[model samples]
Target: MRTRLSRALPAAVAVLAVFSALPVSAATAAVREPVPYASPVDHPSYIVTVRRDLDPADVARLVGVTPVHVFDTALHGFAARLNPAQVAALAALPGVETIEEDGTASAG
Candidate 1:
């Protein structure tokens, strides 16, 4: 009985050590920030400013529209008269990092 107790003590200690080294759920949760709120767009055709790094070839393949101009800027803008499916497809393109409706630009 004494030998059996000694073996069980080592196994319990090893199990506790492994679990302590593993990440706790709370540690991962602390690193995440709450998502910001975005306003809704009310128009049928709205312009969107995409990330400037969006490749012309990738945009053409996914969205079928070349930007009005491309240069050294943080963002490039475009008009998209797309349905939900089209928007989702375009958003899935590799170079696209973000999409937000161009609030300042008027389509008319």
Candidate 2:
């Protein structure tokens, strides 16, 4: 009886650990609330500013979009076409700094 119990203990512990981690992973995968864009557009362009440590391309990939432009030197960010849901997910990311609509600047 002792030998049987001992042999099962490690396996049981491993199974328990795996099961306990499932909920946390599932919670993280839950759908995030959609963040409305500053202006309404079918597929709006956004300039996403991220933390220095994060790569703009990687961030774009995570949100399932290809970046139209990647800025690395002066700014750490990327410009991409995104919808409201993508905007929300990108906003919720840890290293994202700001998400703003891409706009034109003209000299006066």
**Superposition error at 90 for model 1 (Å):** 1.6
Question: What are the per-residue Cα lDDT tens digits for candidate 2 across 1-108?
Answer: 257887889999999999887777686787888985453457888999999988899999998999989999888999888999999999899999999989867999
What's every prediction's RMSD, in angstroms? 13.9, 15.8
**What local distance difference test score does each model get?**
0.58, 0.89
How many pairs collide in each candidate, listed in order?
Answer: 0, 0
Off by over 4 Å in 1: 1-43, 47-53, 56-58, 65-74, 104-108
Model 1 is weakest, by summed lDDT over 10 consecutive residues, at 37-46
Task: Give one digit per residue, the lDDT tens place, for model 1 in 1-108.
Answer: 256887799999999998899778856866768886443454344445556656544564465644444433454645544457656776786656555554554686
Error of 1 at 50 (Å): 4.6
Give the best candidate by TM-score. Answer: 2
Error of 1 at 39 (Å): 17
Q: Which ten residues in a row have the lowest lDDT in candidate 2?
A: 35-44
lDDT against true structure, model 2: 0.89
How far residue 27's Cα lies from its native spot in candidate 2, in Å, is 64
